[model samples]
Target: MSGGVDSSVAAFLLAQQDYDLSAVFMRNWDTGDESGTDKGCEWEKDWEDVQRVCKKLDLPCQMIDLSQEYWNRVFEPSLKQWESGVTPNTDVWCNREIKFGALLERLPAPTTSNKKPWIATGHYARKSWSTTPNSPHTRPRPKLLRPSDRGKDQTYYLSSISEEGLSRALFPIGHLQKSEVRELARKHQLHTAERPDSVGICFVGEKAKFSNFLSSYIPPNPGPVVDQVSGKTLMQHAGLWTFTLGENARIPGMKERMFVSSKDQLSNTIYVVPGSDHEDLYSNTLRVSDFTWIWNDAIPPDLSTPQGFRVDLMHRYRMHSVPSTVRKAETGDLIVTADEPEKAVTPGQIAALYDGDWCLGCGVIKSTSR
Candidate 1:
């Protein structure tokens, strides 16, 4: 439940059903492993909250530690991507690798009428099953759909999990808005009724503390911060990860506000433009590789063809999907071209596809160009 109101309401809503339900809280972060202190991530308190919710619902609950899985599958990969001068959405990978992959695999086999053990989370995403299967012999396939609350929909972060993995999942409060969830929690007198939403990645803590935390793990590689228009070096940067595209350069004593237009890892330099709306900050095409379809066999029929597949693509969470065409190369990589230019489509970020409200899947963006 992450000691949050959303999960508390999810457990509450599911408790009204006849099916068996037991809360399993996964602890994916261990502060002991990091610099040896519990500052930001408080898994113990979250476990306590989960237990309280389960107790109120008259259900059993247990805590499972998945820190090792997170470190290997999510953190390590994110570190590598960050070191390469791109920030990967670790939350997206955490869902695929830890919550759905390792933790789901560790669940005990169903001993009851249900053939496979099902997992329900507080994720803000919806799912549906189709009678038509990918192949005649296979059962109905699960489609990841957008939640009713578009503003709160989390289908983007959920696009990487396999179809089979998605089939065994449930989202109890996917239809409700954030306000409705808070109201429901309050009506039930849940302890977490007023708990504020958790911000950023749990282990990473607040945004202000992020660079400091990352510095502990990554050695500084000094680089030049240059103005894009003038091609003049303004100052030296400790690391490229310290700044993100389109954000204020935050350089002291600059008369006009400057924003990062791009970063060149090869040149070891950060290019800044004078303003946020500069054309240099946007791109019309993104290069992707290792594209993973949720239903691996269900690649769009025309994706590998010259015409490519028509799909709406989202490169960042919470951003509206953009009209795009995705084509598969002979080398098995993907090239996505957006109908309109997009701002800050960075490398190592996931580019998820959608056919209307249904999520197809995602892949890492290798690069972006005009």
Candidate 2:
């Protein structure tokens, strides 16, 4: 449940629907200090809370050990990205690997007599069902879309999941807003109703410093910072990994607020500009690799046509989608041309393609061109 109101209410709603449900708490982190205290992890309290809720509902609960897997799959890869001077979203990988991937691995296989059990979470995203005739299965593929409550839509984070993954997924709280979710939790007498939402990594708990967490894995390598305007070395920084695109990095002799425009890890140098609006920090075109399609078929016919196709593209979570034209580059990479210049289109971030609310697929942004 991640010790949150939305997930608790989701479990309650699933019970109300008479669906057979099991609450699995994933233990993803073991190193203490997650509670912002030296006394080891307080996730035990969270687990206790979840157990109480399960008891109230008379539903069985189990703890799945995914700590090692989470570290190997999500954290390690993210550290590599940070080492290469790219800001990676650990939450995105956590959802893909731990929440969805690990849970699917642990679900008991269904018997031939009944349909396979589906995995449900409290994500606030609309699941689209196909209505076309002659569809292959009795159940259509579930599409990921923005929740009716746009303010809390989480479809952006789930943009990289494969179509097969979405088919077996359930977002029980997709239709409810935050206020409604809290009300349902209260109505059901869920203890988590009044619990503060968990921030950052679930196992890591709230108040955990990102720098502290990162420092454990990536050693600080202080390097020189260069001024873009003066073309001169300004000062040194703790490490390139500590900064990100659009970040105002503090230096020894900077008179004005400076923004990070680029990083050259090979030379251990970071390029800084005066404002957030430096031309080099913007791009009209981006190339993406390792494309993953959410739909079952190949690239949609319209997208593959000679004329190509245009759609809305999103580079990061919570950001508004920008209109873009998609075409296949000579190397088979998806080339996206934004109608207007986009700022901070960072490499290693997924560029999700969409047609209105339906997610087409996503790929890792490789590079950008002015």
Candidate 3:
């Protein structure tokens, strides 16, 4: 539980259902002000809130320290992706590697004498079960779908989860809207009933800035910014990792807002162009590699067949899926043609494929073309 109202209510609702439960609070950072004196820092208070909720529910609670693993697996790899001028989804990696992956690893194995353990989180997404078991060893894998609360659904961030993981995961608050969750919390007299939601990174507290958090691990390298239209130098930036496509990076003389169109790490230069809602910034097609399909063995045969099928393609978290026709290229990479052009189809973003509400698979965006 991230010490938020949603998670606290999730635990409460699960307890009402009479399921045996244990609460775990993951401790991911140690550099913050532990005293909670900083203006926005509240790690200590958040922990206290989690503890109080667990106590009220009579559920055993423990704080697990996964700082080393989180840094090694999630943070470091994310930095490397940014250094190469690609925007990596760190939260997705965190959910996959730390929250679900390491947490399951640390739990005691199930045996004939012991009950199997299942994990529950406060993510706003629904899990659907099939009518019959799909395999002998286990039941059918849970299918991920949008929650009843359309505004709060988080299935996009969870597209990378494997079939095995989804089978054991539970989202207790998936069917409830945020308002309903708050009302339930209030009914239970939970302290976080009216608490504001956590912002920025999950583990990091309010005061933590992304740049400050990354600066400690990634050494800053100042680089030059060049105008893509003029072929002229502009200003220096603190580091390439500090910016992303469609971002208006600060420059010296250019008064009009400029957006980063591309970055060249080999030459240590960033390309900028005048910001506008123009067609040039968008593209109709993108190439995706390193594909993984959650539901099928390989990309659907229909995707490659002469008779094409339309699918929903999501390139980033919270962004609406764009309708597209997906086809397999000669080299085996998936080629996606958006019904309408998409803006800033950056390299390194995960391109997830979906059919209706079910996530079929995902792959990394390798390149794009106009």
Per-model clash counts, in order, read 0, 0, 0
- Runs with alpha carbons beyond 4 Å of true place in candidate 1: 35-41, 131-138
Q: All candidates' lDDT scores?
A: 0.87, 0.80, 0.79
Q: What is the lDDT of candidate 2?
A: 0.80
Which residue runs does candidate 2 get wrong by more than 4 Å?
Answer: 32-39, 110-114, 131-139, 203-208
Clashing pairs in 3: none
2 or 3, greater by TM-score: 2
Candidate closer to the true structure by lDDT (higher is better), 1 or 2: 1
- Taking the tens digit of each residue's C-alpha lDDT, what string does model 1 give over 185-281? 9899998988988887887668889887787888999999999899889999989888887788888888888899889999889999887789999
Pairwise lDDT winner, candidates 2 and 3: 2
Candidate 3 per-residue lDDT over residues 1-370, each given as its tens digit: 8799988988998888866678988876654434444445455677888999999999888888787888888877888987777878877777778887887778765454475578889999888976323334354456788888878768877888777777788999998999999999898799899999777776454533776666666788888898888888888877787777767766667767778887888887888888765454688798998777765443466777875668998887777888998998899898988898888888888898788887767788988887
Q: Native-vs-model 1 lDDT? A: 0.87
Clashes, model 2: 0
Q: lDDT ranking from best to worst? A: 1, 2, 3
**Strongest candidate by TM-score:** 1
